[model samples]
Target: MTANVQNLNAERYSNEVFELWANQQNLNKSEDYLLKKYITDTSKHVLEAGTGGGRLSFYIEEKGFNNISAFDVVPNMIAHAKKRASTNDSNINFSISDAAVLENYESNSFDYLVYLQQVLCFIDKKDLFTNALKEAYRVAKKDAIVMFSFLDYESKIYNPALSSFVNVLRKLRSEEQSSRHLPWLKINNDINWKLFHKNQPKTYWVKRAEITSLLEDIGFSIEEVKNANQFSKNTGKRKGILYVVCKK
Candidate 1:
């Protein structure tokens, strides 16, 4: 079953809320580095899974990449993305589709596949996640690249304030029980306060060894695994996220 939070009208949340926490820290530069480093210079076909609000898509467009496509499971989010695309006069394709299933698209049609922020964490099942990767590989060119960022579970556990807040939100969402088992979080309650609190999936803190092994098992060659903070020096003391790039 899909997470209850995924069923919520996420587009109702202001776009500003998505940027509020990261904007202050200049994390966009780090994200840009991940994009530039993994995305091939010759790549024209690109796909972004779970492209929420199209913030990163806009950045990709600004970097002059044409033939970009993005999709989100939430229809409202797609509506907002379409609106944003219209406002910006961008011709990028936007669609509403589940991340776990991309079979409708033609195979070997893309050169790069990107999953930004906590998109991986939002997928609740390991098989589903693996299938998504398989689909990415199928849709990408023989040597195409797939890049994504993930939270470091170790860092989250060590931070008292953040951990406490996370636990509280998880409790409110009724996800505390399964939080440790799955990467994605599900908030079942419709309470306004809980909605505002925002509980996210627990970080798997995927180590380089495990990630590399998974990639190899899934027919991908591991290329780079860098602490996203390395690119954004201002991140300071929060070694909670890593950017990984793998080739098909």
Candidate 2:
């Protein structure tokens, strides 16, 4: 992640407004389906990246997945997760971690890897995104299942005109430019959010073919790929979030 985007995301997620993640009670239909279908072993070691407020961690633990390790780059998020775990007497180990540089974890350590919540999109640069995927491959055991999710470039939510405008603006300023580099908007009531709204931070979007090719090149066997509507009844759109189930 670039320093500017990283700092922006840290500010966005660290705000108390995001602390509501602690009380997120259930997985969406897509997450629920993917988890039940590919990750059925209750005893396996599960590592969840970008575990905002421990939502997935808490759900899986409640479902009997005892060996769970979850992390996020934002310390305030991790603090909230740890506090929730303590309150619930949960066994999950919540920690501060960056997916692109997981120095604290050893190679071939986890049996299952969960990179959902469209966490990869937050990485606005391609090289750092690839590095993060490589880190996932390194920490996962051979043949371990890795579930990933990405923001779909084809989604109706992505406005091509806005993307083009952003590209032109950045190019004029001699900044890096791509159609996939779109701004993050304010979705909460943080007092300082308007400042960020004016100077928008970006998130990278991906297409199915692009991510499929990248994952295969990085030594993962693509097992399944589904768009939002295909994966969940609630999504109601064909081109929203994309989910992929892969193996090392």
Candidate 3:
């Protein structure tokens, strides 16, 4: 389900976008408190998936947890993060690796693994998304904390229609709009969503039950499906983000 080079290149973690994102994130205060409440002392060695701009690294470090390793699929994002690393001397391990295939990390090495900002949605294909979860499970210690977020497509604002399909076609053909939304569905428990971002390939939106079942199938024990908006004042589009705290 990898999008072609044409689609992948659109807004694909460019330096300009990441700079704006990082700048806005630096102003956020509640995120630190949110992570602090969930992260504990047992998570000495932490791994973060989809380390966009490495903003989470700062909040993670602020809580006195230094042994942090993070990675992103985009080389540009990693380069920017590494540059930011040079200025802070945080020593965070930032690398380039796809979340779907994390061949670099060792099994059972991490106490905590996190993939935030609705990162799973980018893995639009259900099979690869499952494989990614399987990889995350493989890399975590037994009973380790596995925290991540999912974007719920059941939001009222989301109305996938013919226009949405047209938008996707335009994107794939590079004829018109750079980005568009397509339908999202729970086909027998496997989640699927059409590409919305102009860049990158694959898209996925999930239901709570579908995601819970997927995690259980991957051998993770359920802890709680947290509503993340409670921790922040996010509304409208941002309100769909759901944080899942599970054990592996």
Candidate 4:
């Protein structure tokens, strides 16, 4: 992962208001289909990787999933999450962690793990992304459900997030060279499209096949895969984040 990507991830989600926006996302749905369908027992130990501002953590708690812990690479984001947790009196253990290296967690510690909101895309290096998957796989128990979501390369428009990153690339390189030297490098046999989001820093995207193969390689079985945005339709069609549900 590039230092630029790391700095960007830290800089973007520093605000407290973003947490409210994150929580507001699933209000329309009567059920968290991903959580409800895959996670039946509220007692299961849950971990939210890349838990920005603890929005999903808060939501999962509302649904009675009490055994939850969350982490983020950004300290300010974790601070915001901690503030929210304090306000709500939620017993969620918030911590600082890198997905590729779960320094604090032990193997087989959690029953359910969620890498939501395209957070996986933030690890700019494909190998780092894979290593993170390996860590996630290691920490989760057998038959555990793991859900990862990302912004699709085939999205209808270039989101503001992409625009910000593009602008950064443009600044680093001459317009002529940047056109050629974008972040989309073809790494060893992984993904042709590991595009990260700009606004949210390390947030990025990869092909579904690459994700599936990587998960299987790391011992996860594919259960269901779909665009997370499918739940929220706009302009008469589903548009937004790509996601997968896997069982370990």
Please tell me which predicted candidate would have the highest lDDT against the true structure. Answer: 2
After the best TM-score superposition of candidate 3, give how far the Cα of residue 42 lies from its true spot, in angstroms.
6.9
Model 3 ranges with Cα > 4 A deviation: 1-11, 22-24, 27-33, 160-202, 232-238
Clash numbers, per candidate: 1, 0, 1, 6
Worst 10-residue lDDT window for candidate 2 reads 189-198
- For every model shown, what is its TM-score relative to the native structure? 0.73, 0.90, 0.76, 0.74
The worst-scoring run of ten residues by lDDT in candidate 4 lies at 176-185
Error of 3 at 207 (Å): 1.3
The local distance difference test score of each candidate is: 0.64, 0.82, 0.68, 0.70
In model 3, the worst 10-residue window by lDDT is 178-187
What lDDT score goes with residue 184 in model 4?
40
Could you tell which candidate, 2 or 3, scores higher by lDDT? 2
Please write out the lDDT profile of model 2 over residues 136-160, one tens digit for every residue: 9999999899999998887755468
Clashing pairs in 1: 153-205
Query: 3 or 4, which is superior by TM-score?
Result: 3
lDDT (Cα, tens digit) per residue for candidate 1, span 71-178: 877665668788888988998899977766785588888788887775765555556666766777778888888887776554455444544656676677775333
- Each candidate: RMSD: 5.8, 2.8, 7.2, 7.6
lDDT of 3 by residue, 1-248 (tens): 13444225224445325555444355233345547666787448989887777888766877788799998776777787888888988888999887778889989999888777766666645666778889999999998888878766554354455447657666576853323223334322454343343433434667678888989999999886655565555444435567788898
Model 1, poorest ten-residue lDDT window? 180-189
- Cα misplacement distance, residue 180 of candidate 2 (Å): 1.1
